[model samples]
Each structure stands twice: as C-alpha cells, then as structure tokens.
Target: MSQPTDSSAWPPPAPRTPRHARRRKLRRAALTLVAAMAPWLAGSWGASRSSTCTPRTAHADPSFWEQVTQEPEEAARLERYQAEMQRGHQQASLVLGEGRQRDVEPLPPLQRRQLTQEARRAFQRAARIRPTVAEPHYYLAVFTFFALHSCAQCQFDPAIATEIVEELEAFEALSPLDPRLTSLLGDRAILYTRLSGHATPAKTREYLERAIADYRAIIARSAGLRQRWELTYGNLAEALMMIGDLEEAIATYRLAQRHASTASILLGLAVAMDRDERGVEARTLIRELGPDAVASWEEDVLRGDTFYVPQGEVHYYRALIAETRGDINGAIAAYRQFEQSNAHPQFAPRAAANRAALTRAVTRAVR
Candidate 1:
C-alpha cells in the first residue's frame, strides 16, 4: 500500500457526530494505557484483513419497519420512526465503542468483523428510516470503507461504492449550508484516495485530485473553525505529495502551519521543502521546532497519546535538515536516533541508505 504522510497533529479533534464521537472516545480512553503498548502500535488496531466481511443484516426489514411502524397511525408513526432512528444511532455507537477497544486490547479478526457488521446494520437501519438525514449515510460510507481494507478476503463491492456516492449526493442536496457537509465531502475525498491505493495510476491521480478539490472547497468557505482549516490544508498537502506535486505541497503545508501550531504540520512543511530542494527553509522550521519540543511530543506519542505528530518521524526530518545544512555528523546521529528509537518500517530503509552514503562520504573526505 502506498503510505500517506502522517496527519495527526491537531489535538482534541473537532467535535464529531454521534458515531464518530464514540470512535474518538475509544482512542482517548486508550491513551492512558498507550505507554504500556509497543511504541509502533497505531492508535487503532485497524481491522484485520485476513477474513471476509459479512453485513450483519442481510437486508433491511422492509415489513417490520415500513408496515408496522409507518402504516400505523400517521402521527404516531412519524414519532416512532424518529425513535427508531435514534435507537439505530445508539446501536451503532455501542458497536463502535467495542471496536475502539482495539486500542487497549487488540481484537481478533472475527470480533472486528462482527463489530463492523453490527455497526453497519445499525447505520443502515437509520438510513432507511430517515432518508433525509446525513449521519447514517456518512457512517455507512466510513464503516464500509474501513471494512474494505480490514476484510482482505472480501471482494470489492461496487454496490457499496455506489451507495456512498448516492448517499453523499443526497446529503449535499438536503443540507447545502450545513458546515458538517464539508467534513462529509472531505470524507468522501479520503474514501476515493484510499480506493486508489490498488487502482491504476490514472485512477490514483484522479482520486487524489478529487480529494484535493474537496479540501480546497472547505478552505474557501472555512469561516470559524481554525482546527478544521488546519486539518484540511494538511490533508490537501498530503494529496499533493502523493501525486509528486512537491511545490504545491510545500505551499499548502505553509498555509496549514499558519492555521495550527503543531509539530506535525511543521514536519510536513519541512519534508515538502526538502523534497522541493528548499533545504534552507526546511532547516529553519526544524530549528524552530528544536530538540526539546520534538522530545516532548514523542514522549506523548509513546504514552499512547492521540493528536500529536508521530513519535519517530521528527528524527527523520531533523536528519534531513542536518543533511541539507552539511552537518554530516548531526544528520548521521539523528538517523541513528530514529533507527534506535522508532520502528517505522516505511522510512527505515531510506534512513539506512542515507546513513551509509554519508558514512562513505566522510571516509573519503578523511582519506
């Protein structure tokens, strides 16, 4: 899978919908015990990919809901329908809470699949009962996408993809002005981007471009939510980087930096600047971050804290900054620190190569 840059900088993520709130709560609850877990463990033990996912409810109970609930006294039926929808939301939240336990105690494949299926069933019921509301559809899309990767044995379901688009289209029609709609759009963008992981290059570019467009739209209308704006820009920069648009990525990260103060954004900007050969600029930002600040943030991450830049990535960026400034020893040391302290499988090889090349250079210089 193509890895996207880490985007976990904003703490206390913006308020979420009921289902998402529950999911976030799971992470927060796990944070207290995160220090006890392996430093490399992700915040969530994402769904297991070994098994196939089966929707808990094969199909909505057309008769039980449509006839018994809706066909009863019309006035009472509406009230009952609303109640059912609320119940559905609650059900989904309950399943999500269980899934979140993966942060504390890793879930087995069967349990993960069951939780996702149950959540989907609840959300599906809500969507059926309240066709106009966006929450059910939003959660459905999220859960489906998440399960798609987790259930590696499952075949891609075109129907689910179609459902997500149709639901999002309906949501936009229902609430054009609701601010939460922006988040939904961003979610859709991410969905497409994730799909592009196993897609053709053209498709990958197309999805990433779509994600960028959604992010840009949010930025255009972002009025009050500084946190959302920061996140959107960071996401946009990440998409840009995926497509090798280094210059734009650098520019977008700079924009994100102004909106939020976090090591992740700074590191993002530093990485982009380095890629674009703006090493001096990268060094400046890294220096501003300083060693102490990076250490504190890493400590938080090690303790299973949520909403901070990742633990070991800082060292990688610092090494790059040192290399740009011709500080061979500093660069080598930072690279070593990263290797010793963090198990970032993706960056480890590159770090080793950089270190080896620098060591060779130093040996020649001495000769």
Candidate 2:
C-alpha cells in the first residue's frame, strides 16, 4: 500500500543503559535496522503489479476512494473497489482466517473510529459475495488490532476480541487444514503483535511464533512459494529482536540474509551485528545502506532534513564507533545527523535533544 512515505528507523539511546552506551546504541540499532528493512522485505511492487492489479496505496487508505470521486484518473481504484464490491460473497475474501487465531473483537473506538468504519464496510461488502472468504475477516481483524493501538482513550475490548476469535474458530472448523491456513494465520499473528501494545514481551513473542510458523509452513509446502515465504524472514527477525531474543534474532536474520542480499537485508545484518556487540561488523552494513536512504520530501522530519529513513537509528548506532575512537564531536555529530532525519512523531523529544545539544556544542566551540 502506498503510505505517507517511509518512517525513519534510526535507533535511540535509552536512559537505562546510557553508561553502556555502546550496548545501548547497538541494541537499538538492531531494531532500527529491522524496521528499515520492511519496505524491501515486502518485496518490490514492480513484479507484483499485473494488468488487473491496481495500486495497493489507494486501497491502503480510504482516501484513495475519495480521490477517485474527485479525480477521474483514479478510475483504476474505483474499478477495483467496484469489482470487490460486486464480489460481495464470503469466498470473495479468499480466506477468512489466513494465518493465526488472532480474531480478537471490539477495538478501542476513539482510537481508530475512521478505520473501523472502513473495515466494517469493506468486510460487509466482501461478505456479500463470498461470506466464506477469509480476506475480509482477516482484514477486519487487522483493522481492529490497529484500532486497538490508537492513542485514543481505550482499553482491551475482550468481547469484540472474542467475537473475532470465534469467527476464526468457525473458519478453522469449516476450512480444511492446509498450507493456505499458513498465510492467513501469519497475517493474524502480525495483527495481534501490533495490537498487543504494552503486553508482556512474552505475548509479543508468542504472536510472532504463530506468524513464524505460518511462514515456515509456507516455505515447506511448495518450492514454488519459497520466494514469498522467505520474505517473512525479516519480519520474523524483527519479532525475535523485539522480544530481546538477540541470539535467535541473529540466527533468523542470517537465514534471511542467505536467501537474498540487498541494502535492506544488509541493514538487517548491521542491526543484528550491533545487537551481538559486534560493532565492527555492523559498520559494513551502514556503509552499504549509505548516508541517506530516505526518499526526499519537503518535510523537515528530523531537523531540516528533506527525507526520513528512521536514520536517527543510525546515530545511536554510529555513536558506538564515535565513542570507540574517543571522538565526542563525531559522536554528537552523528546523533545530530539522525535527529535531522527523524520522522516518527513518537521520538520527537530525543531527536530534538540531540539536535539542540549538538547545536549548543557547536556554538560553544565557536566562542
């Protein structure tokens, strides 16, 4: 789906381990690297697009639908929407429960009020054609999870969660168990992981485990599907890292690296290396990812930077190297560089601090 550009994945320096700053940088670096690699992990959209295949961006957001209403060129989106609407059947969704049993219901209402509406309408439309199809159900579950994470005042909606789970349970009863379930389950696990919020890392790990199972099953079923299943390797790596399983995360990343090597994968490797406390090895990736990976946009996301690649992550990463060489200015400069490219709204404070600290340092030096 075409999104509002990419989010920066720069690592941050947390307060807990400021003294073990090297470890802090690398640990955070691993996560940043994994997040940065997601776009590539999803695989390029080039081959994915076919004559019938419409863009995923417009469909990614409801705005695309509204755009078609205004601008005629968005006819493709309208056509796709209409077609999907026409297929209002359960089977039309293709599968109700693709990967996991994460059919949780009732989401935080205020958080994703708009998205909930979209999901309900889309799911209802699809259910009209193939009430049996899992696509709509899976998507609805995904939407609910996303809504669950919104900043709006909300808590776990156990009932809605139960409803979605029952839907998936019914799906399991009617649908034959096979590799097809892997894809559906994988999606469900990802959704659950996203919605789990501050839940124990154990829960997140469990969700990822389900996702990983689906990915691995897909790989095992047919050799023809290896490329697609392999893509989940990065996702698995990210999940493992998030749970603080650095050892398993490294292994998972290496496995993915063996399948394909690109800037994204290399970035993953760099992150893994940072996690493993192998700063020297991590550098190899940073060099390859280049100084600026984000596409240019007008926004000064981090500082006055024109793009965002989650590069503030890079600052926390390179901080190790700067510290290792006893170069305070260089370390601070790297942090500032990351701050300039920060895009995520969540990390604004730290980014600002880095920018301000560096600015004051520069000013004092001139004095």
Candidate 3:
C-alpha cells in the first residue's frame, strides 16, 4: 500500500517490457482505439460514399469532378435523363416521320401528339432526376406546348389547356429570377411567344415584356453565349415587335445584326426601321444586304446564310419597308401571298399576327 518514493519509479516501470512486447502492446492499444472509431468513420466516409460521389466532369474540364462532387448523384441522374430524352426524341422523329407522315415528312397529327406525350414523359423523368437543372422544366413546357397548346399544320388540342398551364408554371418556377437567368428561360420565352398568340392583352403584354427583358438580359451577358447569337437576338426583336415597341425592337435587331449579320436580323431591322418612320434608311439597309438575301428558304430552316444569298429574307424586308411607309394593304397582301407558300411553324404566328393587324389597319384607313 506504500507508494513508490524512488524517482526511477520501480526500475523504470519494468523497462516497458521487451521491445517486441512493447511493440505488441502499442499495436494492441492502437488497434483498440481504431476499433472504437471504426463504425463512426465508416459511416461517415466509406467506400460507398466515395465511390458514389464521382465528381462532375464537364466537357470543358477533365478535372471538374470536384465541382460535380457537390452533387454527384444528381449529375449522374441528370445525364441519364438527358440521354433518355435524346433517345426518345430520335425514336419519335423516326417513327412519326417514316411511318405516318412519310408523304410530306412532316409529323402527322396523331404521330406528333404521341411523340410530344412521350417527350413529356422523358422530360418529367429528367425533372425528377435533376431537380436542380432548369432544362428539364423547359423541355416539359416545350413538349406540353407542342402536344397541347399549338396547332397549324399539326392540330393543337384544346383539352390540354390545364396541363399546358401547369407545365408552364413549373417551367416558370424552374426559371431564374433575373431576366431569364438561364437558357431554359430562353426556351420558355419562345414557348410563351406561341402561347401569346391567342392570349388576352394582359397576358400577351406581360409575356412580351418578359421576353424583351430576357433578351436584354441575355445581351448584357453576351460573354457566355456564342453559338445561339443570331437566334436569340432575332427572337428578341420579334418579341419586342409583337408588343408594338418598334424602337426598342429595331435597336435590338440592329444589335443582333452587329453580332451576326444574318438575313433574318437584317429583315427584322428593316421592318423596325420602317415602323420607326425611317423607310429610306430601311430600304438602304435591305439593299446593302443585296443578293445576300434569298427569294425563299428551301431547307424549311430560316437560319441565316453565311455566304449564300438571302433572297427570301430580302423580299420580306422590302414588303416590310412598304408597310412601314403607311402601305398597310401592301404589307398584308405580301404576307398573305408568302404565307400560302411558307411552311415554318415558328414564323406562322408572327406572320399571321402581322397580317391580321395590317388587315385591320387597312380596313380602318379605308373607313
């Protein structure tokens, strides 16, 4: 019961045992500590967590895995959904075109509707897979619009109005706050433009304003987008014109033309200039495009010419010039004649709107 009084402490505590024994004892203690921590460490950072969290690797960066790691599972699910959507789209195109609409190569009504529904399913899956991504909601809105909200060469079903509205709301929620924070908003804007056709003034006005704001916001962030330059600006101009803001629309068209000297932008600029009471300037602008314009777009795609002449676009501009110069009847007739031969669905709505407006204006003028 007597405590050791010697400073050596009872022969140095038995020499800490043999060096080999000491090693074993130390190892045993170390193992015991590790065993105590094993479950906690495993639960927090196991093979499953590490293996499952493969970092996101962007096509632009081979080492973007770190960034993607923040949401690795979501990224994988998103990729799967995108691939599925792509597959569905390809299948839909092949089946609808080669099977039912082989005569014109355009989608038959039933086929188009079916494809849209299938696409909707894919997009819905995508939205679930990557709730953070905006593209899924955008696609959902698109498929809904195609299948339900619109019809011309393809008949639109009025029965799906509520569905379309629901999908659009979803898209809007997924949409960013500031002037279309992402390209998803751009897609949404285009979809809404179509919806704007039969919408009341209140609805149409709000949509047009949003579209214009989106375009301006996009222009402000010109650093990020380079591929869809012409399309974005051209669409913005169209949106502004729809709202009857000729000045802003013309400027936007010109701005877009500066970035990309496409015939469509030129045409839009001319129309806007004429509406702004600058018919001479508009004509000069059209003439400058020269044989760069075409008489008609043969490809059914109105994407601008690089070196080839933009004949159809020029003619459209010329007619716009006359209309801007108070020739309402002339513009209406020109649009009507062109509509009889034109096939692009994107253009039909605007062309029809212009035609209707011109007809009304003419009727009033005559009265």
Top TM-score prediction, candidate number: 1
The TM-score of predicted model 1 comes to: 0.51
Tens digits of per-residue lDDT for model 1 on 1-367? 1112222211121133343443444455455345434332432233233245322322334553453333334444345445554554454444344434455654576776676677567667656766776656655655565454223344545456556656666667776776667655665665565555545667667777877887788777766655456667777886786677888888888887787857667777777666565656777887888777667655654543312122454577668767866799999999898778643334466678778889999999999
Q: Tell me how far the alpha carbon of residue 166 in candidate 1 is from the true structure, in angstroms, after superposition.
A: 8.1
Every candidate's lDDT: 0.60, 0.48, 0.55
RMSD of 1: 21.6
On a 0 to 100 scale, what is the lDDT of residue 313 in model 3?
30
**Residue-by-residue lDDT tens digits, candidate 2, 193-281:** 44344235465456556555655655565456545433567656655654557688788778877877544445555655665666567
Better candidate number, 1 or 2, judged by lDDT:
1
Cα deviation at 324, candidate 2, in Å, is 11
The C-alpha stretches of model 3 lying farther than 4 A from their native spots are: 1-139, 142-168, 171-181, 220-222, 296-318, 321-367
Better of 1 and 3 by TM-score: 1
Ranking by TM-score: 1, 3, 2
Off by over 4 Å in 2: 1-166, 173-179, 292-367
Write model 3 residue lDDT over 1-367, tens digit each, in one string: 0001111110111012132443454465556556655665665565456877534322324344343343444444545765665655554344333433436666676776676667667767767776765665554554454434432234433235445545656766766462434544454455455445545668767766765675666667666756466777778877776567788788778767777876667766776666566757876776666553533321223332211111233334545645655667777776765466442233445567767877887688889
Clashes of each: 0, 38, 10
Off by over 4 Å in 1: 1-87, 93-119, 122-136, 142-170, 173-179, 185-200, 224-228, 297-360
